[model samples]
Target chain A: MQQIKKDFPIFKRTINGKPLVYLDNASTTQKPIVMLKVLENFYFTSNANIHRGIYTLSEEATDKYEAVRKKAAKFIGARTEEEIIFTKNTTEAINCVRVSWGEKNIKKGDEIVVSSLEHHANLVPWQELAKSKQAALKIIPLTNDYTLDAEAYKKLLSPKTKLVCLTVESNVTGTIVPVKQMTALAHAVGAKVMIDGAQSVGHIPTDVHNLNCDFFAFSAHKMLGPTGVGVLYVKQSLMEEMAPFMYGGEMVESVKATSATYRSGPWKFEAGTPNIAGVIAFGAAIDYLSNIGFKKIMAHEQELLAYAKKMLAKYPQVKIFSPSQKHAGGIISFAISGVHPHDIATIFNNEGIAIRSGLHCAEPLMNYLGVYGTARMSFYIYNTKKDIDTAEKALKKVLKTFKL
Target chain B: MDIYTETILDHYQHPHHTGALNDATVSATEHNPLCGDVIKLDLKIKNNVVEKIGFVGNGCAISQASISLLCDAVEGKKISSLKKLKPKDIYDLLGVTISPGRIKCALLGLSALQKALKLTKN
Candidate 1:
């Protein structure tokens, strides 16, 4: 873990005269030196328009860029590289599915099921799709314990259910959903499933085949890769059936005056010049994570989450919104009894501890939980027990500063 | 810590004029949707002048203290004059430097006050 910490140079930074204790992994993880180097090196040597130029540098750039699709496919256990589509981020990837598949499949009176735990990225797009198509948008409510109510979800499915969108892990509550079982349930009702992997892919083992989801969307920035690059894994058959999300240069096969033929596979969905350096660096990030392996990553995160939970339990004023340890992930969302989340986050920031305090882009979940927002602390491979200890001291300072 | 000084903490801990005005002429509420900090202001006006000012709200120290100080600054002042108050005035009243991120928290009270002033009849 110390070696992993060293891989991220941001740890060397001092905030407010104190060592940084960053716990905002769910928002975005710090980039590692290896991934950063790959990003810089690509621009240095292989800066060229891919798939357009016939020169050697362009060919080399195209090869390196395309190779990441294969790496990403293997990283997530997809069937083939053709199943992966590069987009801006998780939101764009989900929008790609909505525009390409959802807009076509969902009809009037059709049902689109979403869980209570979904981030706005997954929820809003489906809401708009359902609204535009005059379809029914049903939600699977959360239980008293903050986990999605499985019984309610099963009852929500019907013959008209066209799609079920759920997150692999909640960015707000950090509840690791049983997506595989839920996917199977959606499949039983003849509905395709799209798993939002923004929070899960980086922290846990994610296999599209094992989960059996039709689509999976995640951001590179949240997984130790650079920003502006994300992956959308579409099942092979579904990818063939779906339309191209955007159409322009590189996606077209032949341009007639009136109509143009489109390229096959993921390239069709990627319309213009993609994030070449970010994608190539994302490949290096995949390699970096693969070298460390998920077993170690998950263990370290779970340990940190458990220790933080233990530390938070000592504060009676603090209320935990995440599920119990068995179902929780590497994130913890909580609020003090009298202190607002913003105040808590400010005090934490003063102490050089970075934790997110807001609705976390999950306002619907916050509304359901009956809180304006909760302060969140998310762990990753680089986080240590010492970081959690510093966060605890900051938490105590918040209580003191508020005179609670 | 710099933003939360002794004066701000005093106002936060012992807020002034924090009750709903039953005989109010106008009232308005403003909130920072992201932070969930809300400020509701009630005012009683006489001859285009503010006779009394009160408020009730829930939020962080900065927001609550800002509104507390705002109540004291606006009471007995002319409604037309109160509308001229700027965000800088609120920062000056707080007597602390408000960062860009906390600007909304610091100005929420002023926004509500101005909104109430707009609702006041001439």
Candidate 2:
């Protein structure tokens, strides 16, 4: 774990005269030096537009860009590279599905089911879609312990349900939903399921085939890649059925003055000059994570989560919102009595420990949970027990500062 | 330097002029949706001068303390003088260098006060 910390240069820096203790992995992971080198080398040596120029540079660039698609497919257990469509970020990827597949399939009086654990990126799009189509948006409720009510989800599914969107892991509560079982239930009612893998892909083992989800969206930046690249994996058959989201440039098969037929496969959704360098470097990020292996990464993160929970348990003022260890991942969201999350975050910042505060882009969930916001500490492969100790000390400073 | 100074913490712990005015002539509320901080200001304006002022809300120390300080600064002052108050004045009142991220928290009180002023004018 200490060796892994060295791979990220940011960990070496000092903030407020203290060593940086970053616990905001769910927001965005720090870029590895390997990923940085790949991003820089791509721009330095192979800077060209893909699928446009007939020159060698463009062809090489296109090959590198497309290779990442195949790597992403293999990484997530997609059936083929043709299933992968590169978007700007996870939000854009979900919007792609909303515009292309949703507008066509979702009709008036239909139903769309999402969980109470959804980030705004997943919830708001579907809410807007339901509003535009005059459809009903249903929510899968949470148990008292914060895990999803799978029984309630089964009852919500019916023939009228056109789509079911589920997150593989909750960013705020750290609850890991049983997506495979839920997807099967959705498919039983002929509803297509889309999994938001933004918090799951790099942290846990993800297999689109095992989950049997029709569409999946994730951001590369959350998994140590550059900021501008994201992946949308549509099942191959659905890929053929969906229309192009953005219509321009290489996405077209042939252009005429009047009308044009779009390209087949994932290229249909990628319009304009895409983030070529970001895509190629995302491939390197995948390689770096693969080399470490998910088993080690998960073990490392789980250890940190357990340690953090144990440490936090010492303070009676602290209330944890994450599910039990068996049902959750590396995230630990909690609130200290009489202390606002923003105050907690400011105190942690003074100690050079980075944590997230506020609604976490899950306002509805926050309202449901009956807290205005929460202080979240998410762990990754590089985070150590010592980092958690630093955070614990900073948390003490928060209580002392506030006289809680 | 830590943005949370002793004065900020003191104001947060024991804020001045807090509560809803029963006969408030004008009132306005402002929310920082990013962190879910909300502040509501109530004024008892008489003859275009501030007769009394109070604030109530739930938020971080920066925001609560800011509103508390703002309430102290504006009471008994002329309405026109209150209009001249700027963000720098709030920072000066804070007695600490506020980061860009916390500037909104520091100025949330100013925002609500301005809105209340607008309501009174109308």
Candidate 3:
């Protein structure tokens, strides 16, 4: 934990004249020094466009860019590097799948199954696809505890289901959806599966092959990597079947006045000059995580979450949203009685403790919970139990301050 | 806890003119679902002047206290005058420059008051 804290230089700084205790990992994790330095080194040395020139700098840039792809492929346990395609973020990655796969495959009368506990990025693209394709967008309801009922999910799946797009971990509730089981079920129904791994990738160890999802989407920023970079892992066989979403310079093999030939699979998906520095920095982030061991990171987070739950449970004013499931990831969402989440967050901010308060880009889940929003504290390796202790103390003071 | 200024905290802890005003001609409820801040404002107007102003709700100290302060500031004032009250007035009264996000919480009460005034004028 001490070593982990050292990696984040911003953690040493102060906010509002007080020591910073950042708990907004669910929004975006702080980049480690290794990731930051990797970015700096790229700009300082190999500052050139990738895959275009035979110059040494360009060759170096291209190698670094493709190397990150290999790292990202291994990071998510993709079967091959060709399955990975870079995009702006998870939002874009999901959009790529919606445009590339849904545009071609989804027809009128087909269905796309998604869970109620999805971020707007995961939900909106599919809704737009359903709208354009005249397909049915079926949402599997969440149980009272915020878990997706497998029975309800099974009932939602049918031969008419063209795709099942869902999040692996809900950003709002921290509920880990049974993605592997759901993927298997979707496959059985002959529907493609796309798991939104935006909130899951660095939070937990993910194996795409083991899960057997047709595609997985996630952002680098959520995993202590640079922003403006994300990965969309398409199954090799499925990649061959899907059409390209975008067309332009980097992706095309040849262009004529009337027609154009495009590159295959991942290259075809990447249409323009990508975020080279961000992708390179992402490789550094992967290395940092690999060094720490994802298992150790997961264990640390689980311990923190357990401790946080136990500490917060003492406050009767506090209402926890996520179920007390062992499989739930390291996010805690709760509402303090008599105090609005914004108020709680405001008070915490004054104390130099950052937390996310609102629907967390998951309005459907917020509606299902019957709460307007919640104050969410998400844990990463850099976070300590002491930080949660400070948050708890601050929360108690906030409750008393509000006369709750 | 210091998110609310000392003045605002005082008002929150001992809210003035809080609770429903019976026989009130105007009432409105405003909510910031993002924060779970709910304010139920009750106002009585006579001859275009606010005869009484009161509020009841569940919220943070900033929100509740801001409403209490709003009640004190708006009572006996013209409903038309209250309609022009901006969030900055509340922030100035609190004597703190709130973060952009918390400005909404600080202003939730004023927004409710404005809504009530709008209904009363109608």
Q: Specify the highest-TM-score model's number.
A: 2
Candidate 2 per-residue C-alpha lDDT over A1-404 given as tens digits, one digit per residue, 9 for 90 to 100? 67888899998899889899999999999999999999999999999999989999999999999999999999999989999999999999999999999999999999999999999999999999999999999999999999999889989999999999999999998999999999999999999998999999999989998889999999999999999999999999898889899988989999889999999999999989999999999999999999999999988888888899999999999999989899899998999878889889989999899999999999999998999899999999888999899998999998888787
Clashes by residue pair, model 2? none
Error of 2 at B32 (Å): 0.7
- All candidates: interface RMSD: 1.3, 1.0, 3.1
Q: How badly does each model clash, as a count of residue pairs?
A: 0, 0, 0
Candidate 3 Cα errors over 4 Å, as ranges: B5-86, B108-122
Each model's TM-score for chain A is: 0.99, 0.99, 0.98
lDDT of 1 by residue, A272-352 (tens): 999999999999999999999999988888898889989999989999887988898999999987777988899899889
lDDT of every model, 2 decimals: 0.91, 0.93, 0.87
DockQ of each: 0.70, 0.82, 0.42
Pairs with steric clashes in candidate 3 = none
lDDT of 1 by residue, B40-94 (tens): 8888899888889888888888999999998898888887788889999999999
Residues B1-122, candidate 2: write the lDDT tens digits: 87667898899888999999998999999999899999889999998998999888989888888899989999999999999899999999988888888988999999999999988773
- Assess candidate 1 and give its lDDT: 0.91
Task: List candidate 2 segments past 4 Å from native.
Answer: none
Better of 1 and 3 by lDDT: 1
